[model samples]
Target chain A: MDLHLSERHLRFRDELRAWLEKNVVRPWREELRDPTASEDSLIELRRAWQKKLHAGGYLGLDWPKEWGGRGATAVEKSIFEAELVRADAPPILNFLGLSLLGPALIHHGSEEQRRRFIPPMLSADEIWCQGFSEPGAGSDLASLKTAARLEGDEFVVNGQKVWTTYGPWADWIFVLARTDAKNRYGGISFILVELRTPGVTVRPLRQITGESEFGEVFFEDARVPRANLVGQIGEGWKIAMTVLAYERGATALAYSTRYSRDLAALAHACREVGRTGPAVREKLARLVVENEVMRANGVRMLANLADGKIPGPEASMEKLFWSEFDKRFRDTAIDLLGPGGLLLRSCSEARPEVDWAREFLWSRAETIFSGSSEVQRNILAKRALSLPQEG
Target chain B: MRFELSDDQRLLRDSARDFLAAEFPLEETQRVVEHDPRGFDPAAWARLGEMGYLGLTLPAEVGGQQLGAVELAIVLEEMGRACVPGPYLDVALAAALLAAAGGRERLLAEIASGKAIVTIARQDAAFAGEAPCGIETANGKLRGRKYFVPFAAEAQALLVTTPGGVYRTDAPFAVTPLPTLDPTQRFARVDFDHVAERMAAADVVAGLEPLAAAAAAAMLLGVMSRAFEITLDYVKTRQAFGRPIGSFQALQHRLADALLRVESTRSAVYRAAWCLDNADPDAALAAASAKAYAGDAARLVCGESIQMHGGIGFTWELGLHFFLKRAKTLESHYGSTEVQLERALAAAGL
Candidate 1:
């Protein structure tokens, strides 16, 4: 009945906005803009920024207070995210760990495991990477070939994981490895493997965006302590599903604000295109309407989440819808950009290189990652709609 | 912030659904669509009048429940689901304008009681938003021909739009039904010759134009939702290729895509409705977005619903095509998606 944020939440947003505005510095801004800037320094500054956010009690807004979170309401978290986007702050360096692994651990990990992982992730002291997809296993993650064998008190892991975001920077990875190869899905186990262990080699891959934000991780006889196992050895499918559930939950829900900003910027860019044909105008106009819908839909999704049910098919549906929208949005932005679209990096203020070209390339990855649109549709068909699979 | 309906709102919506389900079954709706001259069952209008739903948004002084646009939207959604045949939207819109323009309290009560039918002959369809071309006015009397007047035969009170402003008349005027893509609603052309009525300087209808657009879109929301449910039901039960057609991935994905539009349309309409209730500055653009998206989405969902249903859907008895017709009607009722998109773009200062 009400979509307006409460006074308390608005106050929280204002406070957070003030803190972010005061803390995010000019140097960090320049570092993000300057392509030649050193990556390590940017990472360090971002890590420090996460720690600063933590020190300000801004981290883990939705986690229960007993587990070091503010126990914030879903609305507050939604507002917090909106504020973060509004400030144009650098993306939290330990994003995957904080949003994905931390929530999964909080829900499925042991008390000791939670204590061991949650704090470091909160402080950005330990970066985490996901090792679910492999070269051969993508949409069909159940067919993953990674194997982990228990030897004495350790599990020796050997596998190659592709599209591993933060692989080079991660200190640990919660990987889905086959423990019971005989049972395709039931055999998989969710194992927390440290990247520092011997045989763990992280190779960064150059992306279409020409940045190494993600990499291919090679694990050969990587030793993981038995204590690192989250839940049962053969129950990783359920645990991995939980991780995916989180991926499609608040983190997925939070993309709308950033999308709204991107859309606004694109609308601004769209006006600069001279002699725009009717086709272009129609596309631009459609994008505007869709952008508004995305914002509204995100609010609806958050409301559903607030009702205290782990989002089900709706999340997957959103995952399918928004990622597709993200790509089309960037494509339209480029189409309107004309000659400027071809520039690998746009430095012109009228059309920022990073915002347009780099973004268009990055948008290509949206559909490929986080359960591709095809996979999402399949999930909707099989799980949500209870339809039979074609095998 | 709560985005879902409240318990009270849900009750309002459910009651409307229950009433529509019982009073206006597909058979009855078909009769209304095909045979009824007024394009709706008279008894059903009386039933809604008894329930005080006709005056849902009218003020207390005017015998209305004083509920906001959200209630109207919820009721309209159920109307679409039931395929309720009537000039309900035209009536609701006319009530809104009359409430704002004032000096129509008695008429508002009649509308609230379903004792009177009123419709806004605004700029819509062939001459939508166009200032009247040959409108002749002298001594507070009007004479002109109005195009695409909704429910002209049924309405006892008509708020006709002209270049000067809005004028009201209950005096006699010639009414001629015209061919329309949609059979569930009636449209007519009215020729006016010295129909004695006073003109009023009213911007209320102009102010509520976006909301009027949004209301039309809300109807599409219901139409698509029901269409989806019907198609889904058919796909689940109707066997093809030795199994339920829904089991096919192509069909399943197509249905899912349709569901996505349906879901997004629901969101867009609700948000647009919410903007109206809260008086958000972005109301105009939000309404345009709601109208534009819902029209296109419903067409896709309704058309695909028929395609998925196959031969049975193509038949007249199936009544699936009514959704397509109704969606097509509402799509161009206030304005086509392209027209609304331009309105939105202009509102956004593009």
Candidate 2:
């Protein structure tokens, strides 16, 4: 069982590392700690970074080469993520478009749709937000009440999508709206609606972290062209399921890298504060052990991917692990850091290494979003374990 | 980069599993635990040596297969699944220490041929929170006591640890059995008064801790996984409230969490074994992490197996308690989770 990177993969990593070293002028932490940086300015910074990555031919890393990709394997994609974390580079502004919508359109969208959408999506000219979750249809996404009726040349849509991450700045929303009201799963249609359409509205919602990173989108009889529909009318659920599967890439490596950096920072902070007692040291050591295990898990996942193994229901285990561990790590950081840990990033007394307060609050949303911990557990029980369904 | 066992390793695992299943089923283990003074069947122990299981990691010069840690982990994991009764890990480690000291070829051959039994006697205390190194050398003879020496009553010789070095002490008298949660395990406190010959420096066995931790964690992985599987099967067939109890969301979610721990332990155990086999830079930290993680994971999975089984789980006749008890013993020994945590921290330079 070999875990060493192949020569080709090593070359890919070295080249990417060199590119990052040359291009990244300011690490993301420095940008976030800038007192004058506003939300819009930070987003512009990320957009600029995305453009740089696209120019470097690093975007859509594992996608087919015909669509501006490097035609890399999953191992390369995992290494790209880990390198980004190690460099502390700013996250791309159009991640939803690149990760979710790009795969969906490449696989299920009509040729015309791909031609119109893929380029701008890669270039960060048009940002995308998911319109799948709503106030009434979160864990039970198929129960969505969003309706879309076909008119002469357009589909009239009416829906309210909540927890719309990036909706505040996105130019488009790919929605799952009901076209046949009687059928639960098959009636759903995947439609892309412009944010500036006549009756569409986007209102930012303040999160517990005191940021408007996500918002709610309202659709009041918005007319989207029939050409915006992806695939057949009744195939939205199938397409959406496949799109979610794309999110299950080897993310553990990136998560562990980022966490390790923050953990080292926390350890330094503890030393600076002279909190090196046995109890505190034990807590820090446990976190260290846990993070190392997470790294092992990530390495195993990458090795399996390289071994030509398809990820199955075990992806839920990864999701549950990182998300839950985030909460524990953040909670321990706050406990060890004392009251100073709760200070906002703008506060002068706050730790500059990590936005501890923001992460502490943001970790709450991680378990709730994507797929909630409960949903992941259900997936493991029903799919992986093959347990009997509830009567 | 591949994470799976190679073809030869897979063959070893399959053969080990088949042999252990046939020769050391839970019923036979139960019989040994109940009546065998040696804590293992003599015939079965001889079979293991004949099958080359005893010398899995020893060099060919000593009549061994000269395999690596991954192969040892595979065999030990299967033994754990079968709840095989013996001092397999103890004897293998003792033999390795002797091999590393660069002498005693005859004893090594005897060990590989199942003609003799030897195990390390290292523990200096009978309980936690006590000062260590009570055992020392005096008058060219080993003195003081060593606690938790595996199979001390049955071992023909004991490699006793002293303040200065490790000494080979032949055994004839003075062994007090210290039985606890696991009946299949035979630990003892040995009053070492025999004339001793210093075998090697104290640090000669420095490399053994990680190997021991990784191998023990592999055994824990097997124990928890088998317990989980047994519980899963039980819930699928056992009825409650007019339907299978596994259908309830409460049981389902808990079982899901249990599965998470079991699988995570598997990943950690194999990764540690691989790192050690390859002599990778991360070997120490990976082995420590695997042991620490597996200790807690085995506790949860084995405890949940009993909880899910309701009443029969607690009964001795059902044999679930044996797994739970064995898991506890494995957790506290072979470098306990607390010790591994500290080792991991040092390895990571935290």
List pairs with backbone clashes in candidate 2.
none
Docking level of model 1: medium
> What's model 2's TM-score?
0.99
Which candidate tops lDDT?
Answer: 2
Worst 10 residues of 2 chain B by lDDT: B127-136
Model 2 complex DockQ against the native? 0.83
Q: What is the lDDT of residue B332 in candidate 2?
A: 92
Lowest summed lDDT across 10 adjacent residues in model 1 chain A is found at A345-354
* Candidate topping TM-score: 2
Considering just chain B, what TM-score does every model have? 0.96, 0.97
Error of 1 at A351 (Å): 1.6
Instruction: Give a tens-digit lDDT track for model 2, residues B1-350.
Output: 98889999999999999999899888888888899888898888999999999988888888899998888888888878887888888897898789888889888988998878999998888777788748778888888988899999889888887769889988684999998889988899888778999998888867778898899999998899889999999999999999999999999999999998888888888888899988999999999999999999988999999999998999888888878988999999888888898898788878
Off by over 4 Å in 2: none
Q: Residue-wise lDDT of candidate 1 within B247-328, one digit each (tens)?
A: 8888988988888899888988888899899999878988999999999999999999999988888999988888999999
Root-mean-square deviation of Cα positions for candidate 1 versus the true structure, in angstroms = 2.6
